[model samples]
Target: MSLYMLPLAIGPWQIALIVIIVLLLFGGKKIPELMRGLGSGIKEFKDASKEEEIEKNDKKE
Candidate 1:
């Protein structure tokens, strides 16, 4: 089966409710640390992809 390309259906109210739930669950203080870790993980993923693409181009040339 193929994945669909449509955007996720969450509206603004849904987003606000999810944020409220997260705040209640993790509290205000822990969210920043969580976000920082998430950011670093994204950066590492991007760096890895770029390295892989460079390697592919090097092998082709």
Candidate 2:
């Protein structure tokens, strides 16, 4: 029996290539808008989780 292992290393060139690809696909202007949307979504999710925790603690008392 043989087991295969995938490489798990990322170097600077690999990162640069990925950035180039993303820029090409999304364009320079749309990238900032996409990032802003993603950041807001993450913030909203965290806020919702915090509210749920607060409600749970109140119910316990």
Candidate 3:
């Protein structure tokens, strides 16, 4: 039963490697823009999903 909680761990080296990959993929100058675009897209998706749920509820009512 206790096996489910086996600790999840990420070390500093793993973080550094992820950072290096991001920098190489996006380049230093583009990272911020990419992040902003990602943020906006995620927010838009969330809003669209919520709107659809609300519309469904309204139709049911």
**After superposition, candidate 3 runs with Cα above 4 Å error:** 1-9
Task: State TM-scores per candidate.
Answer: 0.85, 0.80, 0.76
lDDT of each candidate versus the true structure: 0.93, 0.92, 0.91
**6-60 per-residue lDDT for model 1 (tens digits):** 3566689899999999999999999999999999999999999999999999999
Clashing pairs in 2: none
Best by TM-score: 1
Candidate 1 has an lDDT of: 0.93
Give the higher-lDDT candidate: 2 or 3: 2
- Per-residue alpha-carbon lDDT of candidate 3 for residues 1-61, written as tens digits (9 for 90 to 100): 2665534466788889999999999899999998999999999999999999999999999
Residue 32 shift from truth in candidate 3, angstroms: 0.6
Candidate 3 accuracy as lDDT: 0.91
RMSD of candidate 1 to true structure, Å: 4.2
Q: Write the per-residue lDDT of candidate 2 for residues 1-61, one digit (tens) a residue.
A: 2234335566789999999999999999999999999999999999999999999999999
TM-score of candidate 1 on Cα atoms, chains taken together: 0.85
Model 2 lDDT at residue 61: 100
**Model 3 backbone overlap count:** 0
